[model samples]
Target: MALQDRPNEKPEASPADLVSSLAEASLALARAASEGEAYAALDMAAHRLAALSSGRVSICELGMSPNGRALILWQSSRGGLSIGEDSLFAEWYTRASRMGGEMTPARGHIWYGLLSADTLNDETGIRVAIFLKFDEMKEELAAHAYGLADIAAAVALRIRKQKAAALERRRFDGMYETTRAWLELGADIVWEASPEGILRCRRILNRRGDISRLVDGMDLRSLRIGGGGQSLLDFLEQQGSVRHMRAHLPEDAQGRMSTGETLYVSATARRSPDEDAPYIGTFTAIGRDAPSDGTRETATMLLQMRGARIREEQHRREAEAMLQGLRLLLSQDSSREKMSRLVGLVGECIGSSDACVAEKGLDGKVRILVPQQKSPGPGAAAALDFIAAGAPRGVVGVYDIDAAEGRNIADAFGLEGCQVAALALPLRGDAAFLVCVTRRAEGFAPADLDFADRFALLLRQALLLREEQSHLAQTAKMAALGQMSASIAHELRQPLNTISLAVQNLEFLLESLDFDREAAAKKTKRVLAQVERASDVIDRMRRFGRKSVGEHASLVLRNVIENVEAIMHHVLLRAGVRLEVEISPDVTAYADQLQLEQVIGNLLQNAVDAISGIGAKHERAEGLIKITASPSPDEKGMTVLRVEDSGPGFRPEIAERVLEPFFTTKSAEHGTGLGLAICDAIIRESGGRIEIGNHAAGGFVQIVLPRQPA
Candidate 1:
C-alpha cells in the first residue's frame, strides 16, 4: 500500500492515489452497459496498477467458456510488453488462478501472475493475467497482481449481463421478424408442438389466406397428413427432428380455405432433464411452388433413367424379332418357294409392300418370280436385262424408278404414280434376283439396304451349297474309280511279275538243255495260278465299281481288316514293310461295307507309303505297320481301329491339323491330299470320330465307330 516499498515504482505516484483510481475503475466495470465499456473499465484498472509498479506490464482479461476453458476477451499492455505473443503467457492466463504464477525464459525472462481467483470457475466469469519482465521489475509488483481478484469479479458480472441481453435480443428478432418475412414470401405456416403429438402453437404466415382459422393447441393428428405408417409427430420423436417433410393436408371441419396442396416442412426439437421440461419444437412450411435442390435433381435423374429404359426395351424387341425372322427363313427347304416366302417375310418385317424375286433364266434373261405365272412387261424385261448385264461385282445395286436408267422399268411396271424402290442382287450360277417394294413414303434407309444384302447372301449361300454337294458327289465317284484302279494295278502287277519269273525259269532250263520234267510242271502250274489270281482281281474290281451308295449292314470289323491286308499285303511286302494285324473276331460295326473297305484300304496304303519313304531315306529294318481293331476304351457300344507305322511322325505343330481335308505331309505326286480327306468324310458320316496323333516312336491314326447293336 506504500510506493516506497516498490522498487520498480514511479517516484511521484502515491499509494492513496493508486487505491482511489482502482476503486473508480471497479465502479465503472460494475455499472458497464456493454462488453466494450466493461473491457475499457478493466483495462483502466490494469494500467493504474502498472503505473504504481513502475514496470512494463500487460493485462489480458480471459473468459471461462461453458466447458470451463479460458479465452482472452480483452488485452491491455504498457510500454510494448508483447505478452500475447508468448504461448507460455497464454497457458498461464487459461489456468492462472490455479497455477498462481509462472516464469518464461523464451525471448526474455518474464514473470506471469493471475489477477482473479474468485471468478475462475464461473462460466461467464472473467480471469485476468499480468505479464512483466522479471529482471526489469521489482518483486513488490507481484503483490498487486494477486490483489486484483475483486476487480475482475465485477468485470465478469457486467459481461455476463450483457451476453444475456444480446441473446434475448437475437431470440426476439428471429421469432417475429424472421417468421413474418417468410410469410411474405408465400410460406403457409410456422408452428410449434410437443413430443406427444400435442400442438402448442400455430401461426398462419400467409396474409391473404384464411389459414389463420387453423386451431392452435390441437393434436397434430387432427390435420390428418398422410405419410408413412408413422404420424409426423412420431417421426419427429424418433429422428429428433426432420427437415423438408413433404405431406398432404386433408379437409377439416373448420371452414379454413384448405387447398390440399403438398407442403414442405422443416422442424427441430430438444429434450431437457427437468420433469417440467417437455419436448418442444418449431416447424416452418412452404407450398409446392418452390422445391429444394435435392428434389429437383432426383426428379431429373428419374426422368433420364426412364428414357434409357424405354430405349433398351425397344432394342431388345428389335433384336428378338430379327432372330425369329432368321430362324423362320432358315427352316424352309432350299427351293424357289423358300426364297419367295423369305422375301415375303422380309417385306412384312421391314414395313414394305409388293415384294418380288427375279432369277436369271438359262436363256440369258432375268425373269420376275411370283406365285402365279407372269413375266415382266417388255419394257421392264429390257431394263432388267440391261442392269443384270452391267451389274457390278460384290455390290447390291439400288434403283429408283424416277431415275433416268429406271424409267423403262417404271413405265413397264406402271409405277408412274407409285413410289418404288428396287434392289438387284447377283446370285451364284449366273443368276440375278430382283426385289421391289412399292408405295413407300421415303427411300430405303441404310439399315434396310444392309438387311436386303444379308438376305441375298442367304440365297447365294444356299445356291453355293447345292453346287458344292453336286461337285463333291462327282469328286467322290472319281476318287472311287482311282482307288479301284490302284488296287487292280497293285494286285495284277505281282502275278504278272510272277508269271514273268516262271517264264525266265523255263527259258534257263531250255538253254541249259538239262530241264527236269518236275521243274517244267512246277513252272507251268505257277503261271496258271498267276493268271487265275489276275482274273479274280478283275472280278473284285468290277464288283467294287458297281457298289451302291448307302448300302450298309452289320459287318465284322476284323473281316474288313483281313480283306484290306489281303488286298495290300503284296504291295506292303514289296515296300519291305511288315504288316501286323490285331483284331478281335467279335468287333463289328454298322456301316457301308464298300466305304469301310475303301477307308481301310486307303489307311493301309498310306502307312505303306510312309514306311517305304522312311525306308528309302534311312534303311530302317524296323519297318513295322500295325493295324488293330478292338472295343474303344471307356466308351460303350463303340469300336476303335488304329493304324500305326514305325515311320517318322508328323511335326508337332501339324499333329492336330493332320486330319483336316487336303492337309497332307506327302509329296504331291504320291498323294492328291484327297485320300485321307475322303476317308475322314466316310468315317465321320458313319457316326465315328477320327483322331490322329504321334506316339513316341511313330505316327498313329485312330478311328472310333459306334458298334452295331446285336
Candidate 2:
C-alpha cells in the first residue's frame, strides 16, 4: 500500500508484509492485561504500520475540556504533528468544534483519522486521533489507516469490560470479609456437618476461652441436650433443622460435664437441598463466658434477651392452661368433690405425691377436708394447726423436710428413707384452710411455688364467689316473696271465704226445722276441700322461698315449670299478665330443683314488670308471658328454657349490662336488680348459661343446661 503523504512511493514491501504485521499486532492486543497496556499495544501497532509505509505516526488522546473546548491529553513522539500549549491540531479543533472522523491535512503528506471516538465517555465526547505523515496520498494507504482504527476500537471495548469486572470483584471481596467478621462476632463456633451427622469442620471464634474441644470427625449422636434427653442427631433427624437448640457436649478428659461447669450452648443448623450434602450451622454459648469486645457483647446480650422472652412466653402459656383446667374442675364438681380434686391438681402442678387441704375449726382443731378418711400424721397435724392459727394468710411457705424441724413432719407423714420437701399455703377465713403438698425428691422451684400460690388464691376466690352467690340467691328469694306478699294474702282470702260460706250454709241447714242431712254433708266436704287448697298454696310458697343447696339432678322440665307457675301464679294475676307454659313432659334438665325454680320465677317476675311498665305508659296493654322448654338447637345434649314477654325489649345499649348486679332500669324503690344477677349465678353454678335478648315477639330470657350431669 502507498502512503497518503507520499503517493509516488511504492507500497512498503508487499501485501504479505501487511498481513504479517496485522497478525502480530492483533496477538499483542489480545495479550494486553489492562487499559494502559492495551493502549501501549495500539501505539506499537501504529508505529509498525507507519514504518511499513515509510511514514511517521502519532496517536493522541483528545477530549472535551470542562469549558467545551477540545484538548489533547497525550500524544506519541514519532510523528511531526505537535500538540502542545499552542498546536495546529488545537487550532483545527477550535475551527471544527469536534474531534471525530478524518480531518483535512494541514501540511503536505499529513493525514488525521479518528481511531476510537467516545470509547471511555458517553456523556462527554472523547476521541483517539491517529496522525500519519506519508510521502504521498493513495486509496490503498487510506484503507490501511481505517483498518488500524477498527482494531483499536475493538481493543478499547475489551479494556472497558476488564475495568468493570475488576471493580465488581473488589466490591464482592469487601462484602465477603464484612459478613465473615459479623458471623465470627455473633457466634462462639461456626460448623459444617456431613449428611450423616458427622462434624466436618468447626471454627471457634471465642478469644477468651474455649469450653468445647470436640473436633472434626466427631459424631453428633454423642452429644445430648443440655438438660438431658434425646441426642443431637436424633433431634436433627426428627426436626430436619434447628434454630437455637441447646445441647451438652460429652464429658472431656478433665471429667467435667456441661452442667457441672454451668455451661449452656445454643445451636442453629439448616439442611442443604441435596440429602447427601453437608449442613451449615452455628453454636453460641448461653450465659457463660463474656465476649471479648463491645460489638460481640451487644450481640450476646440481644441473644440472651430473646431467650428470656421465649421462656417467659412459654411460662405464660402453661399458667393459662392450668387456670383453664381449674375453671373446668370448679364448674363441674360439687364442693366436697372439688376440694379433693383441687388438692390433686395442686400436687400435680408442684410434682408432689402427697397433698391435702386442712381446715381449722373454731376449737382450733385441724381436720383434713380433702381425702376425707385420711388424717394428717401427728407432726403434719401440728404444722397444719400452726399454719392455720398463726401463718400469714395467702402466703406460700416451703420447708426442707430433711432439716431438723421438717424431719419430724416427714417421719410423722410416713415419708421416711428419702429426701422430702413441703409447701403450705393458707387460705383466708376465720376457719382457715391450709393447702399442703409434699415432694419426695428435691425441693420445689420458684416457678412451682409461684404456681401453687396462684392455685390457692384461685381456690379461695372460688369459695368466696360460691358463698356470695348463695347469699345473693337467698336475698333475691326473699325479695320475690316480698313482691308476692299482697298477692298471697289475696289468694288465701278466696279459699277462706269459701270455707266460711260453706260453714254458714251448714249452720243454716242445722238450724232449719227441716234440716237436710245430704246438704249438710256436702257443705262440710266443700269446707274440707277449701282448707286443703289453702294448705297447698302455703306449701308452694314455703318451697319457693327456701334456700337452694346446689344439688344437681335430672328433673322433669314440665314439673319444674309447674312448681314455678304455682309460686308466681297470683303475682302474674295481680299484674294482669297471662302466663303460658309450653314444655314437653319428657324433657328433663340436670340442675338444682330449687334453684331452677328460682331462675324461672325470677324470669317470670321480670317479664311481668316489663309488661306492667308498658301498661303504665299505654292503657289496656295485653300482657303475655310465655315459657317454652325444649332441646337446644345449637348445643347437643342440652335443654333450653325460653321466657318471652310482650313488652318493650331491652335497649341495645344496656342489654349486656342487664344481668350485672344492681343494674336496673326500674325505679330504685321497686327493683333491687339482684333478681337477674342471682338467676345468672345459679344457672352458671349448674354448668349452664343464660342469654337475654329480644326475640321477634318481644324481650326474651333463655336458659341452657346440660341434659345429663357433666
TM-score, one value per model? 0.33, 0.44
Poorly placed runs, candidate 2 (over 4 Å): 1-345, 352-457, 509-516, 614-620
Task: Kindly list the per-residue Cα lDDT of model 2 for residues 299-364, writing each as its tens digit.
Answer: 554566557656765575456546544553443233444455566666666667675555554455
TM-score (C-alpha) between model 2 and the true structure:
0.44
Give the alpha carbon lDDT tens digit for every residue of 409-502 in model 1.
5565444423444555555454655555555657565566666565565555544543453345346545645744655687789899999999
Candidate 1 lands at a TM-score of 0.33
Candidate 2 global lDDT: 0.64
lDDT of each: 0.58, 0.64
Q: Highest lDDT: which candidate?
A: 2
lDDT of 1: 0.58
